[model samples]
Target: MFEEHGPPIEFTAAGDTPEEQTTNLKIVRPSPGFDPASELCAEAIIKDADVTVLDFSPQQVTVRFQIDGLWHAGTPMDREMGDYMLATLKQLAGVDYRERRERQTGNFASLYLKKKQKFKLVSQGIQTGERVALYLDYKRPPLDKPEDLGMRASMGKQLRAIVNDTNMGILMSTAVPGEGYTAVWRGMLEATDRLTRDFFVMEHVGKNEPEVINVYPVEYDSAKGENPMTPMKQLMLKEPDVLAFPDIASGKLLDQIVSHSVTHEMPIFTRIPGKHCLDGLLRLVALKPDVKKLTDRMTAVISMRLIRLLCEDCKIGFQPHPQMIHQLGLPQGRVAELFKPMVYQPGMVDENDVEIEPCSNCSGIGYRGRTGLFELLMFNDELRQALVSNPRLDQLSAVAKRHGHVSMQMEGVVMIAGGRTSVEELQRVLKS
Candidate 1:
C-alpha cells in the first residue's frame, strides 16, 4: 500500500555537489528486504516529477526524472536492486512480469501525498537488458476561463470576437507536442456559450471531460477490424454547432473535415503540429490540396509555446547586456532592468563561509510555473485572397504580419522586457 504524506519530497540532483550526491544516494537506496522501486516511485511523485525512466545494464541501473520538461539524473542502483525494481513496476502496472524479453504497456493508479495519481508504464527489451519508462499523469488546475490562459488583454478580446463570430470557419491551434496546444483549445471551447450552442468532440482518448461538451471516443484497431473514420462520420451526422478533434493528420480525414465545414457551415476546431502559424496552415493545405476552400473558410491560427516564469520571490534584477538590448531591438537607455532566476543573496553564508543555498521558494530551480507565449494569425480578406493566388508561405506571412499577427519570437521578447521571464530562459526555448 502507498502511504499518503504531508507534502511531496524534494530530490536534489546527483550531480549538484559531491556531498549532496552522497546524501541523495543514501536516501534513494532501499533498505534491507524493502522494495526500492516503490520507494523511488513514491519519492518521485512527492517531488512532483511527472516522468521517470529506468535503464537496466549488466553492471547497474540508471534512473532519470523529468521535471518541468527537462530530464535530470538520479541515483544509480546495483543490478540486483534494478531487477527487483523493474519486476515491481511490471507487477504494479499489471503487465506480463515473467516475460521480460517482449514489449509491454499498462497503466495503474496510486495514492501519493494524499492525491490519486495515475501512471502509464512501458517496458521494452534491449541488447543490454531492459528499458522502462513511467509517465505520471499530473493533474493541472482548470484554465476554463479565457482570461486565465495568460493572453494579453487585446489578444483575448480578438480571440473572443473570433470565437463568437457567427460566420462558420475553421480555427486551428498549432504547436509542437507538449506545448499546451490542447489546453488552449479546451479553454477556447469553454469560452463558448455552451448553454446555447451544441459542442461535440471526437478523440482517441479523452481528458478533463467537460460537462457541457459531448465527446465521442474513437479507436484504431486493424486486427479488431475497427475503422477510425466511422466514429468521425457518426459525429458529423449529429451536426453539432461546433466540432473539435484533437489533431488533423490523415489526408482523407482532413478532406472530409474541410468538406463538412463548407457544407454544414459549422466551425471546426483542430490542432496541427508546427513551430509557427503559417507553417501549420501550409501543412494543412498540403494535406487537402484544396487551397481555395481551406483559405476561404479558415478564420485564424493560434500558435503557442509554454515558457517557464521566473520565481518572483528569488529573482534578481540586472541591467541588460548591450548586445541583448540590440538583439531585442529595444531603445538602449529606456529599459532599465531585467530579471533572472536567482537563488542566493549576497553575504548569505553557511557554517563553512560558503553561500548558504538557493531560494527555498523555488527549490533553487529559479522558476515556479509556466505561462504561454501566443502568436495569433487572424485571416482577413487580403490574406485569403493572397493565399488563393500565390499559396506561398512567405507572402502569406507578410500579409499576416501586416494584419497584426505577432510572431512567437516577438511575444517572448515582450515577456522578457516585462520582466516576466529572462532572456536566457527565452533563448532556451527559442534556441536563438
Candidate 2:
C-alpha cells in the first residue's frame, strides 16, 4: 500500500468484481500469461536491468541475464550461479551444454544469458503493439569476483577434455548424421607440441571402418633392447611377396608384420595390444618417408599422462607425515587437510569458527583439476644400438629405470603423497 493511495491493489475473478485490502502485497499481473522465457529468464527477477536485456522481434524474443545468487560452500556449483538456467535450457534445446555459451576463464558458462521461450500474453490474444508495464523492484545483484572467471576457464578445459575423449571420438560425444567422425586423431598436428606424436593428438579414425589392430601393443620401450617378436617373425616371414593381404601361417602374425616391414617399409615400432584402425595406419606410416624418425617418436609419446589438480576453494590444512614433510622440505607446524565429509565429527575450528576438513573440490581426494605427468625414456646411442641388436623390453625398462627414468606409477604416487592428488585418483589413473 502506497502512503498516498493508502489501499492495496486487489485481485478478482476473471470476469467479476474485486475486493481490496490494506496490505503491501498486490497482484501485479494476475494470470496475464506473460512468459519471461521468451523475453528473459526467471533469474531476471534478481538481475541488473541494464545488463539483463529483453529483446523482442516479430518472430521471437530473447532473454539475457546474469547470475548473482550466493551458493552453498564446498560445492562445484557453489560459485556457479547461472548454472541452473543454462542446464535447463540445455535440456529443452536438445543440445549439449557445451554449445550454449562462450568459454569463460577455464569454465564454460553463459555469462550473458540468451534463452528464448514463446507464449501468448493474454487469453484474448493481445497484439504486439499493446503497452504492458512489468512491475519490477529495480534492484541489481552484486557482481562476482574476477577470480571466478579463472576457475571457470580451468574447469571448462578439463570438462572439454573429458567430453572430447569419450569412447565415440575426440570432441564427439554423440554419433549424429551429417556430423563428421567426431573422434579425430589423438596426435597433434603441431610439430612443436610435446605430445605431437601421441596417437590421440594425431591419427583420427575413419568413419564406418572396421577395427584395425593396435599398433603399439607391446609394453612401451624405454631403452633400446632385443627384438620381442623374433620367434613369430621366423614363422610368418616365409612368403615375402604379398603386400596388402598375404596368406599368413598360423601363429605367425608377427612374421607377416616383419615381412611387410621388410618389403613395403612398414614401421612396426611396437605391437599395440588392442585392435584398432591405428594399427593399420602405423603400418602404413612405416612405409612413408622418414619412417625411422616417426617410429622412434612413439617412445617419447608413451612417456606422459595427464592428471587434474585439486581445487583450492576448499583446501584445508593439517600436519603431513614427517617423511613427506622432510621430502618436500616444508616448514614445521604446516599441515594438510580438506573439507571433511558429513559423516565425521567436526575438527578444530579456524579463526572463522569453521571446521577444518578435507577439500570439497577434490571430494576429499585432494585434487580438483589435472596436469600432465611425463615419464621420459631418453635413449642414448648405446641403447638404440642395443635395440638394433634386439633385447627384451623388460631389460630396456630396467636399464632406463637405473639411469634416472621415472615410471608413470611413480609420478602418480609422488603427486598423491605431495597432496597434489589423492591415493584413490592415483589408483584410478595409474592402476597402481
Candidate 1 clashing pairs, residues 3+ apart or interchain: 8-46
**Candidate 2: residue 427 lDDT (0-100):** 54
Residue 104's lDDT in candidate 1 = 96
Residue-by-residue lDDT tens digits, candidate 2, 1-432: 012321221211121122321110122222112122212323332222223332223344334332221111211112122233333233222234344223211111112223221211111113541111122233223212211212224433433343233121111111111111111111111111223222211111222222222212222121443233333354245422111211112224444444445544432232221111222223333343333333332222122334555456654445456675555434545546422112223485669999776443332333443454433234454444444443445555565567665555665555555556554454554441
Worst lDDT window (10 residues) for model 2? 168-177
lDDT of 1 at 177: 71
Off by over 4 Å in 1: 1-39, 78-124, 202-239, 245-260, 331-334, 342-352, 358-361, 389-393
lDDT of each: 0.72, 0.31
